[model samples]
Target: MDSVSEAQFELDQLRHQARKQLLGTVVLGVMAGLLAFVGQSALGQARPLLESSFGTWQSLYTVVLWALAIAWLVALIQQALHYQNISEQFESRRRLDAVYAERAAKAQAVEEERQRQRAESEARQAAERNRRLNKNSHSTKFDFWQE
Candidate 1:
């Protein structure tokens, strides 16, 4: 495919991937919250185990989640900017095409008008020449037959 089609395809893929990531992130966030709630209340006997695990890993897990979230945000921003650039390029190209088309039409109209004026001038000159020739012929020996 052409470059335009390729870029469009890539944009579409990115859009789909972004959507999936967003949904997955939301669902995972909800599940994590629910798990935390259940563990805090319903599983009292497991508090020591959970607390130890949390103490050992919660900070690290939080950092990792934040990093992933930031990366996703950056990807989304890049995608939006890229899409905007492509849209601007298309808009400028359309405007340029319109300007070129208008110029061509104007040139064609001017050329046609010029040709019409030239034709009219030539016709008037031919008529004037014929009139002179007829007048001169009548006053010359060429008119003997008429006399």
Candidate 2:
């Protein structure tokens, strides 16, 4: 492959890895959030309508909810960094795969060339042997038996 194609392939590999990782994180986070919305302790969600909501310790719960939002943001950033790392690894793998393919193709071409030359040489040698045999027989075939 040319340099341009190689570069494009590498770029694609990186993007694909990053996208996949991000997608996985988003799915998990949303699922967890859903669990919390249903009052699951680990999955507790912020009350949808906190505005003017009257209850004891309401301010405390609101603060806790905001803190959770901040934590989620941090988690997202961390996941992004992790996915970037994964992308780098995937890009390296793609490059290695390309190199291996190139080497294999070159080896196959060399073998084919060798096979072609060998066939041509064998054809030439057989033709020469037939020519010599015919030449000898043409001058030595006049013997008859007498009783």
Candidate 3:
């Protein structure tokens, strides 16, 4: 349709994308928290095992815990970066929305001014026509007073 309609549609799409990104960020944060809790529990359990006998199973358990911690850290970093990206997208959308709003307002103002000018021109034409009719009728011979 028009530019304003297109801009509004695009803005709506951006809003939807922003919402999905926010949801993804939240999911990542939750995953990171879960991983952290699991890692903490593993570490707490490992303390007792370490105090007892230092076995192969204990070594493998520690390695697994380290991997979980690493995964948690990666998830946290990803969430932070995703959040930053979302913020930038929202800012860009906001600017674009403002521009579209201004453009729509300007277009509306221009249309109103054009309509006002048209009305004024029609009024002037009608007034001129009425004046001509009045002048001709007054000069007509059919008017007994004039004769």
Candidate 4:
């Protein structure tokens, strides 16, 4: 409900998202590497066929390896971008907290000042009323301590 809590929740969400993305990148990278290894061996076994079909097994293997390398790089970039997102969210939350705290503090100070002024005014009025009453009483010769 509060701004502070909302910001914290958003920050936590971003952190979780970034972690998931990073984990996905690692898994994908490992998978790509494994595929490359298997592909190279298969290419070796089918050397004659590959050469006859596309000129050379080495060519086929190289092309496949390059493709896999590209995929891996893409995944790595995604992971880095996710990390950046998390950092940006964290910084944003920090700024929000600081701004909110400042506003609350200023409001409290203003309220206290207002209360102090009101109390002082009330005290001054009470004293003025007492002076007026005393003057009237003396003129009337009131409170002679008579029975």
Cα lDDT tens digits for candidate 3, 1-147: 666566556666766666676677667657766876796677667777667654655667667767866776676577567666666766676687788779989999999999999999999999999999887876556678755
User: TM-score for every candidate vs. truth?
Assistant: 0.57, 0.54, 0.60, 0.70
lDDT (Cα atoms) of all candidates against the true structure: 0.67, 0.70, 0.72, 0.82
At residue 85, candidate 2 shows an lDDT of 75
Off by over 4 Å in 3: 1-58, 140-147
Identify the leading candidate in terms of lDDT. 4
Give the number of colliding residue pairs in candidate 4. 0
Q: Which pairs clash inside model 3?
A: none
**Comparison by TM-score, 1 against 3, better one:** 3
For candidate 1, lDDT tens digit of each residue in 1-147? 645555556666665665666566666666656666574454456556778676446555556657766766666566666656666655565566667668979999999999999999999999999999987766666666776
* Candidate 2, pairs of clashing residues: 36-43, 36-44
Q: By how many angstroms RMSD does model 1 differ from the true structure?
A: 6.6
Clashes of 3: 0
Residue 39 in candidate 1, Cα distance off native in Å? 14
lDDT of 2 by residue, 1-147 (tens): 766467667777767777776787778678756754554342233344443453434556556666776777677788798777767766676777778789989999999999999999999899899999888666544544321
Candidate with more favorable, higher lDDT: 1 or 4: 4
lDDT of 1 at 106: 100
Error of 3 at 105 (Å): 1.0
